[model samples]
Structures are given as structure tokens and as C-alpha cells.
Target: MEQDLWSVEFTSLADAIRSGRVTSTELTELMLARIAAFDGRLHSYIAVAPDLARAAARAADAEIAQGHWRGPLHGVPMAVKDVFYTKDIRTGFGSSIYDDFEAPYESTATARLRAAGAVMLGKLTATEGVYAGYHPSITEPVNPFGDEHWTGNSSSGSGVAVTSGLAYGTLGTDTGGSIRLPSACCGLTGIKPTWGRVSRHGVFPLAESLDHVGPMARSARDAAALLGAIAGADPDDPTAASVPVHDYLAQIDAGIAGVTIGIDRDFIAAKATPEVAASIETVIPILEQLGARFVPATFPETREILYGWHTECSVEAALAHRATFPGRRAEYGERLSALLDHGAQVTAFELAEAQRARRAFNGAVAAMFAPIDLFLVPALPVAGPTLAHMATLGPDPDGILAVGPFNAPFDICGYPTITVPCGANGAGIPIAFQLAGKPFSEALLCRAAHAWQGVTDWHRRRPEL
Candidate 1:
């Protein structure tokens, strides 16, 4: 039972905790033990707060015993990316300069999760400034599925921990594909909520306009549950949207019957590997069988749109780090320093032009969604790359132009996007497909993903530790 507990999905695990079938303490300990056993090789965590987690779990167990049930997240054990500020906890932000810097206050997302009765196991590893492809303070997190394979960028440890069962679910920020790319590479379900849909109150920002906070989980249903708990406007974050928050799980099982899904075949053929293309082809028939109708569509030119995103993000990131970069320049990692150097060179006119292009791109995407319920595309162009291959790329180690174009565009448009494991390549590494929807349409996106998971076991498959 203890061994099996690690593999349980978030929803079922919550039910078990509420029903006394499992105690939060038991689950917490199990995960801690797993981390101790496996994380030396995985390097998925920056810190492990076993004492704090145990105390929280005990409190959750007492609350349930007293019949003060919180919700599905009550007594759930999870970890979050180190970018989210946790009060009194050292948040390195994957940099040596901030290695001893502890946050004075908690991020709004972590506070909400705590209120939901979730026990945080610790802080997971992240990239430098949450902008690069690798963590400079710690070893780059290894892919549990394959040692040589990439674990995706920025949210690398969040993906590793969830897939390896070190935690049930985790919060990861996506500026341009940080969340969804990891989900695709790790064979998990991840959602990048509409920009401003989730509060960025205390998160370390990469690109202010494009940053998003969302959940990475083992299944679409779990992602929906996590989104419900943390999403909504916060007075602390002026940019958080003042829109109605829907119950993401309420209609998650609703099938995508009669829903029109648009496919950009030209984009797929141009950017995707043959195996990834084949995996997407395989899922189209499966989705069609589940009653979804497919239609051909064309997206805005990828190069033009992504160039705007890059320019905007680079400039914003440079501004965010201006206090230290170039001044204390030697302190930053090689790749991040290079990026900041590039960002410092961006002219004010270039930033304004990028913003204008972004508005136009968002309009085009919104118009495209007018006729189709969702847009389906390959999440990553190929199976996960090797750390060595990524290293060779230097300053832009993420290879965004190759594996991330499908994801970055949605971030630029602030659209809700979810990536679910569709199938695996010939080597058994997972390949995923993304479903993007209109802004604030996370519930609808999860609904379609949940329906797909109902018929496929891809989301349920676990890596051999």
C-alpha cells in the first residue's frame, strides 16, 4: 500500500486522505523517502522541508478527524518550483547570488495552496532567474525516464519530481513554454493558464507581460483541481485579471463531442520530427473517435510572432535584472549573462515595436478561435534532447526555435494551453500534443484533455525509477 500510494493520482489520493484510507503524514513520509532514495541522481529538489511538511500533515490529519474537511487538496503533499517565494525558506532562484536569500513573505499561489490544506514537501530546483535552460547552483535535473534525455527548461525539477512520484503535483511558471515544454518532455499533463489568470504576486519574474503560474500534474483532472485552488485575481498583483473564476473540475469529464479542433498541418510538417508527427496523427483519429471534429487551419507566421516574443521577453528580463546584471555581472551564469547582455542592447523603439506585434498576434489568435473550439499542435518537435546537445546551443540553450515555437506563441497571446501525453516515440520516450484555447478557457481546455485521458493510458504510465 505504501509503494502504491506514490503512484496514485491527485484526485484519488485526496479522496483516500479525506476517507481516512491514508493520512497526510503517511503520504508525506512516503514522498520524502522517495526523494531521499532517488533525488541524489535526479537533483529535482533544492531543499526538503521534512519537519514543516510533517507538521502541516499532522494538522491536516487532525482537521479531517474533526470533520473539518477543506477540499480535494486537503492533506495533499506536493512541491513547487523554487521561483515562488516561501516565507522564511531559502529560494535560490537557481542562482548562487541568491543562495542565502530567504523570502520575507509567501507568494500568493503558495498561500492559497496552504489554505487549501496542501502540505508542501519542499522547494524544487529551477533555472537561473527562471530564464535559462539549466540550474547553475545545482546539477541539471536528470530525466528519470532516460538519463541522457532533456528534462525541459526552467521547470526541469518540477517535471522530474512529479513524474518520478517525488510529489503529486507542482506549480511551475511559464514565460514562454517553461511549464508545457517540461510536461511534454516528462510525459505529464501541464497547463499554462491565460496570462493574469493566476496571480504572480511573489513569483520571480522573467518577462512581466508573458509570465504565468500554473500546475503540472500526472493527469488533466489533477491539473484542473490544482488550477481551481490557486487561480484568481489578487489585490497584491495589479496585473491579475478581475475575472470570474470557474470550477475547473466541474465539467472536466464533459467529452469534446462535436467540438471543432483546428490543426495547422503546415506548421506541424515544417517543425516536428517524423515520430512526433506520427504521434499527433495517431491521436487525431482517437480524438475523432471520441467525437471531436478536425478542421485545417493556418496560424500566424511562427518566425514573425516568436521574434516579437523573444524581443519583448529579453528586454523585460534585462530590466528585471538590471539591478545586478552588468553591475555584478560576473556573479551570473554564462548563459544568463549572455542573455542579459543581449537584452541591454535592445532599443526602446524595439521594445515598443515588439509590444505592437504582440497585440496584433493576440488579435489573430483570438480571431482564429472564433471558428474553432481549440487548436491542436505538437507540444515538442522531437523526443527529449540530451543535456550535451542543449549545452552546445550556448546562450539560448532551450532550443526554443526548434522544440518550443508551438508553445511560445500561446504565451505571447496569453491564451490558455494544456499539453497531455498523447503517445511515445519508437524508443518509448513520450511525445505530447498541445490543446490551446481562447483566453480564460482553461476549464474547456482541461475538459477536452480529461476526455482524452479517459480513453488513453499515456497519462497513467509511470517511469521506472
Candidate 2:
């Protein structure tokens, strides 16, 4: 095995493993070794299932030797956010209260990946209850690009593991900006698939209605492959869309020629920081050069919906935790506790107003997408903020609340959005832009992102872990 094999993308790794040039055991062991060597500092995983991974790898190798090639994910090693239940594994939903809890069955998404022959590297870390901050007892994953920089939560572990070569790809759940924020912060390609496009059954939730299960990887094609393996309607999750799952890998090469990309320049300029604005401006021409046509578009008024996001998410989160919270509230972290406390105080009238606003926001977003196949926007207003700055977000909520303008609306509307590295800041931290489309339009978004990645080396760059 090549010494740098652990650093390869999911697509390449899959191809190699399927071709028998790289055995699953070899790849799995290599990843385990890397985690042992580096996770002390990175803390990208909540638990390391070495025995389970090795057993699965051996089984995959045996099956492949017998001519049973599963698919693109065969013999590939990957991990998922701790929120996704892994049968019999300590599925800590980033909360100490459930640190010893193990599910009898796995999440539909992770189960699908396992059936597709992907090895379980383990459960990656996430924020407490899959909300904004880590549990006081849980160590946060350090940004591989810069130690002091934030690795966007609550999928911080997903971003760090992939970018730092600990995992080729990982499943990330996004309610707000969990997936996209980490992808932007860590310079990776992440897809927050249309809500219901992927099943959430058996997965722990922070905000049930808003939560989305998706993949994060080093490239668009790799993300597409992961998405394909895990997507499709599941009986266990009635909410999982009954629509057909595209062969995203096959659709990824369709290219973006003649595709209409909507750009709300005034919206971006007003919402994004100078660094982010400049980086997004730079990505526009690159996409144009690839034959994507850009057109002027204006975003709908967002303040009402954005403000209401807190109320809705908090209420839902409070509900999701109703079984154990308050009764076991002592075990909960301060941030998550505060969220629940806030939710408990919300009046029935307030919740009704928030839901009504969400409906309006969803309709407005749908209308906005009618003229364009995709809407291009900044993934984050500020790129890779320091850990110290992120700490302040707790006290001065607006700093973090401002992020909803770029990311949360899509979650609110259940639109398919992909975030890809476009440029980097002076300190070499990455800046990314999101391409959001109508529901279940992941194929097109992947095509556009994959095309840009082919012409640009941003996705190929890795941190020196």
C-alpha cells in the first residue's frame, strides 16, 4: 500500500479497492493507524470501532475475492456523525447523557452504506444534541488547516476527519449549517441533500423537521458516490422522499453547460463579509468560463424567517429531547440546556407564527428557483473564524445568528445545496460557495461542483496532518 493512500479521495479509493489493487483490510488498518497517530490532537472521533471496522473489512475482502463487488462504496472505509445510530456501538449523540447508549438497529442511511459495502470507521464527533456547541466533556475537533480556527459544528468531526485524511468521507447531519459550515471551514465538498431525500430513521435529531442527512468528502464526485449509496426512500422513514434516487455518480459528469445559475449579488454583498464576498466574486467567473450562464436574482426578505428559525429549531429540539430532558437535565450541556429552556418557554402562539413564517419562506424560495436551475451564494459570511471568536457567539448571539442568512434558509426550505471550496483566505483557510437548487436537484448541483473541481485544484489540496 502507498504511504499516502490514506489521503486519497473516496472515488479513487473505491476504484482501487474494487479493482483488488487495494484490499479493504489494508485500507481499514491504515485508517485505524492514522487515527491512532493523530486523533489525540484532532479528536475527530467520539469512538473508534477498530474491531468492528476490521471485521467488516475482512468480510468485504472475502466477498470481493469471491467476485461479489457491491458497488462504488465496496470495501471503502468511512465514518458517520455520532448522531447516526450504529447498532451496538456507543452512539453518543454528542451528549454525556447518552454516552453509553447503543441502538439495537442502525440508522437507515448508515445501514444503507453498510449494505453498499462501506466499512464503519466509527462515529465522528458532533455538537451536543447535534446543536451549536460541544458538550463540556467532549473535546472538539480541531481544524486541520489551523489549530486555532474553528472546525464548523456540529459536523466538525466530519470535516476534520475527511480533510485531515482520517476518513475518506463521512456522513454529516445538517439542521442549520452543520455540514456546509464545516465544509467551508475545512475546504471540503459537502452536500446537504434536500430534506427527506435521505432517510433520518434511527438517527438522533436536534431539530427533527429541519435535520438532513448527507455526505461530506474531498470532491464533488466522491460526495455524489456517497450520496447515491445512502439515498432512496425507506419504509422506516415515511418522511424519506419516495422519489427516485439518481445515480449521482453517473449524473455528476453531465457538466453545467447552459445551466442557469442565479446570483443575488446585492444579497450576497449585503450579507457576506468582504473576504467571503471577494472569494465568491472570484468563483463566479470560473463557473461562467465553464459555460454556466449567470443571471440577476433577488432573495426574499429573510429577517422574519431567520429570526423564527431559532424558535422552530428550539421547539423541535426540545421535543426531540422530551423523553430524557428535564428529568435528566443535569447531564445536559449549558448551551443545549439553554436551547431547551428557551423552547419550553415559547408560547403556542409563537410556535404557530414561526411555522407560518416557515411556510412563507419555503414558498418564496420555491418561486425564486423557478427561473434558475441553481442559486449561487456564500456558504458562510466569514471564513474560518477563530475558536475564541466562536466562543463569543454564545454570549453575543448575533455573530453566530448572522450565519442563518447564508445557510439556515435552505435547511428551512428543504432545498438541496452543495458547498465546495472556491478560494482560501490569507492564512490559507478555505472559503466556499454554495449552489442550492430546488428539492431533489442534487444531481445538477453535483455536476456543477464537479465541473468546477475538475478545472480547479482547491478540492485536491489537503492539510499537512
Give me the candidate number with maximum lDDT.
2
**Local distance difference test values of all predictions, in order:** 0.88, 0.88
Among residues 3 or more apart in sequence or in different chains, the pairs in candidate 2 whose N, CA or C atoms overlap within 3 Å are none
What's the TM-score of every candidate structure? 0.97, 0.98
Model 2 clash number: 0
Residue 61's lDDT within candidate 1 is 99
Q: After superposition, how far is residue 439 of candidate 2 from its true place, in Å?
A: 0.9
Clashes of each: 0, 0
lDDT of 2 by residue, 310-422 (tens): 88888898899999988998888888888899899899999999999999988888888899999999998887678777666553135557765788988889999999999
- The digit string of per-residue lDDT tens for model 1 on 1-465 reads 776799878797777788898999999999999999999999999999999999999999999989998998999999999999999567888888887687988999999999999999999988898876553557888888888888898899999999999999999999889999889889999999999999999998998988999999999999999999999989999999989999988888888899999998888989877877887888899899989999988888767767777788888899888888788887888777877787888898988888888788888787878999899998888766666776665435244555577888988888999999987766567789999988888988999999999999999878898
lDDT of 1 at 34: 97
